[model samples]
Target: MNRRVLVPAAVLLSSLSFPLTITGASVALPDLTGDLNASPTAAQWVVTGYNLCFAAFLAFGGSLADLLGRRRLYAVGVSAFLLGSAWCAVAGDVGGLVAARLVAGVGAAIATATGQSSLASAFDGAARARVFGALGTVLGIGLAFGPTVSGFLVDLAGWRAVFWVPAVLAGLALLLCPALPPGRGSGQRVDWAGGALFTFGLGALIWVFVEAPVLGVAHPAVLAVVVAAVAGVAGFVRVERRAAAPMFDLALLGDRAFLGYALVAAAMMGLLVPLLVYLPSYFIDVVGVDPARAGLWMLVLTVPSVLLPGVGAALAKRSPRLLSTGAVLLASVGVVGLVGIGPDGAPWPALLLTGVGVGLTTGVVDGLALSSVPADRVGAAAGLFNTARLTAETVALAAAGSALTLLGGGQPDSGFTDALRVVVVVLGCAGVAAGLGAHALLRRVGR
Candidate 1:
């Protein structure tokens, strides 16, 4: 097969595995929660742990790809993911599954980081946009069908099958790995200190949020961890400023268009991801639907995401700022509309609207973001932009999970609905602010 076909096939297949695991895990969470008798916090960690590792390791993974080789990193990542998934399939308890997920997340971070970098290395201009659009569409395919597939798997084979499926997908992706170009890296110094500080800092923040609901925020242990988290972040900033080669280009934040793209990317995921994570529970518990039916209802949201990225990319060519701002605003409005949902209320309209808004930013943001910067900074931009996205996703998941646990531990009651309302309103308001902020910055592009 042609290298062209092989490279994308490898990347896209691996991309499919990540979101499949992510969304499928959400569908399987209830089953796992019951089977293992895990606490709400512990159960949330099954998902959060994976995201935390993914977010934390992304910059480092990108750096390793640049230092070692994209193909090598990609191969290593996929292997680790396969192993992690296999471990998850056999895990007997929540702790074991969370540990395995963390390992898989690290591998996912490496593969995804290298996937974007490999594309950036191989393509330029319009071609790059198209490939990324294709990438986003594949991601949508994973997110779109993950739940339905997991539902069937769980119904027939059990929750463990969800993990097994991704493991098999990872194995298939590995076969096409050799088709990737093992291009020489630029030999940039890897910022070990910055990576550690950033990863630990974010992990601490998530820990605080997850535990605060159960253990009082004023608890001595929580207070100490909070202080440590703050210090870790501060230390990361300081190290990045002083490092000969920082993991992130701090100066990139000064670029208005780049900043706009980053904000849009973060907001897009913040609004969409929580729904992907928690909506299954809402359907099964609050709406009294079975897991399979809940997955079908999720199609209203995930289907638009699967279909809209290419459209968004094409529209972006005409007016990027318009697309970015409008898509975010649309999503924000859709989220606000979700506050009125009840067991009796029709959720399709609002979910579809939200999906459309979030979908439009899928491939568009990454392409716009990378193009906004100088060619030399494309790698750093990729790291920072993806880091921003995954960070937002992790934080949002933690916040939403904490809120739900606090409200009713996802009990099929009014409390869960009330908590859901609070989450959506906050997310909606914040998304609106981010959209307007991105628009303002994008409009001031030349200034």
Candidate 2:
């Protein structure tokens, strides 16, 4: 009805749709792969392509939103997402599906960057915190229930329903796009060189990780790509330092609290999200569970994500260091315990603990990260932080899929369980290290 209601509604709707699509699509993967006769890598691409493009382009999207106008970018993004979803719904093969997903990922990147910056610009002080908390809760709802809802959809309506649902939501958000504020973009020349270098480098890195297992790490091509990726990323940093209007503010990482929040976000993505993406498939292919039941079983792992962000927000205000460190440590511990579960063993106990830790940290980090930066650079801050998080998600997801495939000898059976255990152990160890690093940084900042 008004700017206030329309803005939040549009942003929140977009937020809800993104995670819904992510979780739902993961649940849809097994069915989709079976129907299309896709190879393991192709099936993984259905998710990885989307995340790779999203992570690679987020910096550009954020800078574009700041320069062109957030509302305009938001509209363009939603439109692209709608188009991509429609294409995905009609895709006839894995190649087509992965292509469509890449489009959707780009759109998602733009939508998220613009949507978050728009919200940050619209609210301040306590109101800003509360709105962000609500954002987290909504994200949790989408994530928590996505698998169960998608499982039923896959059973009743087929995996196509997953893409269709997001398309519909994107259309609704588009209708309310006019209510979004026309943000004042600094009319500066965009740093296209920096953007290109970052995208190329990040894309190269992810491709290497995804392909490494399939093509042994010693392969000449993989080695070449690794060298090129390093050079590209290193080149990006150098370009940014000299650019008149850089896409990202490299200096943001200089803030101890900001860096701390970022590490926490990275740990959340790198450690926890892979389980969400891969476990449903494990339940169905290995544990002999139906899709619907697998989705419901996921609730043990997701319910906390839905319930704990509010508590996390409260904790963040009083003791940010504890929240950052405790959240990661708790999840890491759960994951370590998870390594002991057999194929037939109960998973709920470990999942419950992981859920608590993930839930506690959910949406809280975004708000905390943004609050540390200057208001004028909110768009860049939001973009850069999310780039870090999604990059972690993309890399970790790819690595996990690669590990599963290699260890299982391309089968999702008992070998799959063993691989999953190994993967969990590695994630748990890394998460603990990240948690401690985050704690030290936040403590130094007295946050």
Query: How far out, in Å, is residue 115 in model 2?
Result: 2.2
Cα distance off (Å), candidate 1, residue 239: 0.9
Least well predicted 10-residue stretch by lDDT in candidate 2: 340-349
Give one digit per residue, the lDDT tens place, for model 1 in 1-447.
877777888888889999989988998888888999988889989989999999999889888887899989989999999999999999998999999999999999899888877876777789886787688778878989888888888888988999999999899999988888896777877999999999999999999989999998899989999999999999999999999989999889999999999999999899988988888878877787777877888888888777787788788888899999999999999998899888764467889889999888777788789999998988778778889989998999899899888886666688888989898989999999999999899995532
What does candidate 2's lDDT look like per residue over 91-167, in tens digits? Answer: 99999999999999899889988887888788889988778777877887898999998898888899999899989
Off by over 4 Å in 1: 120-131, 184-187, 445-447
Candidate 1, poorest ten consecutive residues by summed lDDT = 340-349
Clashing pairs in 2: none
Relative to the true structure, candidate 1 reaches a TM of 0.95
Model 1: residue 363 alpha-carbon error in angstroms: 0.9
Clashes (N, CA, C under 3 Å) per candidate: 0, 0
Q: Residue 334 deviation, candidate 1, in Å?
A: 0.8
